[model samples]
Target: MNEKNTLLPRQLGDTHIRLLRIYKVVIESGGFAASEIELNISRPAISAAISELESLLKMKLCHRGRSGFAITDQGEKVYQSTLQLLGNLENFRSEMNAINTDLVGELNIGITDNLVTNEQQRLTRSLSTLKLRAPEVVINIRMISPNAIEAAVLDGQLHFGVVPELRSLSGLTYSSLYQERSQLYCSEEHPLFDKNNEAISDSTLCEYDAVIPNYPQPIKIKHQQKKLKSTATSTDREGLAFLILTGRFLGFLPVHFAQQWVAQNRLCSIDSHNRYFDTHFFTITRKGARENLILEAYLEELEKTL
Candidate 1:
């Protein structure tokens, strides 16, 4: 081979990129069989794509058999590099689109779970308005924990997050949306459920098992420490609700979220005086990141809804 040919780098074509994307989907979905519906491609086609990727790279990327699917060490490095390459490409697209006033490209958002039934949240209406204003924008919403939402936003994995205010992080900005009420609750089968409000003492409340938020919320921690037996914890409302409904533990739940159960007499607030604590929800974003027009427009619509 000539010196020039030996020195020449192998250029990745569009086909290679497509194959890498398929490979990525397969990895993300955990196996070829699981990825077929997600990729909208047949299992054989996916296998072919992975095989082609491996051939192009001159290495085995993964192993698949009756045991399970697992990526090789080389495959892990390639996957990380591919993610960075694709992410940078997306950023480039966003930057080029930013030159125009029109809102386009993807808008990734994260939020704590159990917002669907909350009447105070106007995310649906805000999204509808955003769709009307920027039909070209693709909205991706992820239901995550509060701490995860904050971390994802700071890491650039998410454009914005809707979460209850925790201890503030320095590089993020927060704008309050609303306050939610949370109250101590017990299932119908719990010992205290039938007891009159005045009959339950603080010491008695501390005797039973309690389910609490997995994430660190100062007030929740304080209350749980003082008045409940910490038995289990959860990051999402659904998990907390499940634990509470088992009649095995007491837990704190958003009053709005527990309302249906309360009406059905499956759950009851321990305090009849309606004593509760307030958690403030906020729209959180990176402090010094480049402004995104799509995010700005969406926030404007969200503010209007609020």
Candidate 2:
């Protein structure tokens, strides 16, 4: 090993973190090919990240060739060290999140439906980081309506509730987190799917059947919902999506949530540029509640993710 490679740099930076993360994923995934999907990178990129990590550490972390994929003894040790490092970093975050807060207890979080397609995946990723910080902590997640989540948080049934910023309730603190936009969509079998957006006037849109939400909606969302004839109604996004996919009705869905169908050409936006609404999302907690170390720790991890 070169003398320069024998010692770590004086200060570890983002580059080091990136390399270690790649290495950790590779090890956990068992091979480069297996890690490609999880890492969202190509085999070549995975190979390059591994090579870079090896060069930085001056050691062959794993054996990769036609023969087989296997982790070197040193690689196993480094992986363990990586876990320790992440845990330590989370410890600092938990402490900074609240004064004298212990990383113990449960975190009951409420979240709205159909946010999995979000590109950032900030919520799930932050929860993972929090789990690393407190392996023993019990984290419970509830998927329910925004209003239901609000009531739960206000009533102390939930420590954290994430909902769109339709309206804020008193006696609860809110933190801005995410913003999502929903556009009117129709499946390819619909009459308007092949038509140009410019050709689709409000009158033309109103001529077709549309699905409206049975749940409550904000003023802006309601205005958009009213643009089309309400021939159908759904209690949730999945039902609305089903109705839209049937090509008998048009409905509004989050862009990210509808991407898969759009990619398949089974769904397309209708006057998306004109008929869309953006929803700002927030995390809510009891405003004057007693201190909770678990919630504070999670918020800290989540803030870093944001």
Candidate 3:
């Protein structure tokens, strides 16, 4: 019997790290062609890299025969270790590079309609500053809802989110950018405008037709009012603005969006008392990544525009 070859501990080399990355791609994809697609390398190159990795480890890292390619039990352990090593390596590089001014990654921002209506000026000003400070960094904006923004950011689909601070998110870092209030609005002819009797109860307001946005916060508050039987309406705030401008119906709107209209007499607040909805609008980012300089700078500029 051949004597078992003895192995000595050795430092992992750059070649080993590269091959580990290729191996990860192959295992994640299960096919050489798929790995090629993911790694942006040729299929032959992927196969060759896996062969090199197996030789370096002196063990079968992949069971890449007949039925679709699969990794062995040992391969699974290796893959886990590779992931940890790569993750740590990346964190190290990020920490080192983050000290300098070379901002080179894409920043994905999630924006909701309410943000568009209330904080558009502030956001645009922030972007303008970013463009001058970090021209290399790309910005991708996704328009989504205040309710869904939290999950999307947590899941890494978005780098950050901006929305009305209806409340705090348990796990997120929220920075209040500006204070905003929601204004109750109606056509000039709405009877809630009797103007003589000031305060009306929920039951009294329900006697007339009302339109509402289909968002969790609004829906929750509306449902809590036991006496109101509102004909629930679902539309983006832009559509809501259009409806209000046309004298069709009434609803609560971000004060900024309706301010000009109210000044021009196109829309009127339900009560002269200005029964406004008070909430802080905020910018949210994951706690860990907020330390990234590019993100921090962007947020700093955002605070200035508030």
- On lDDT, the leading prediction is 2
Worst 10 residues of 3 by lDDT: 1-10
User: Distance from true position, residue 140, model 2, in Å?
Assistant: 0.7
lDDT of 3 by residue, 1-306 (tens): 333343213577777777887887688667697656346789888889988877766778777667768888878998988877875664554465477668876677888775655644688888999889899887888876675577556544466788775767677888767766676677666665434227666666677666677655643345432333456566467767766655556677778888777777667776536345665667888666434666777887887775
**Distance from true location, Cα of 90 in model 2, Å:** 25
Each model's total of backbone clashes = 0, 0, 0
Report the C-alpha lDDT of model 2 over 1-306, residue by residue, as the tens digit: 778654688799988987887887788778999777556789999999999888878888999999989999998999889867854554454454356455666678888889888885689899999999998788888888787688557645578988887777788898988889898899999988955365477888889999998878789888888878999998789889999999899889999999999889999998766888988888898887666688878899999995
lDDT tens string, model 1, 224-265?
A: 445677889886789999999999998888889999998999
Question: If scored against the real structure, what TM-score would every candidate get?
Answer: 0.70, 0.66, 0.60
Model 1 Cα displacement at 231 (Å)?
2.1
| Per-model CA lDDT versus the true structure | 0.80, 0.82, 0.69
lDDT of 3: 0.69
Global Cα lDDT for candidate 2: 0.82
Ranking by lDDT: 2, 1, 3
Question: Which candidate gets the maximum TM-score versus the true structure?
Answer: 1
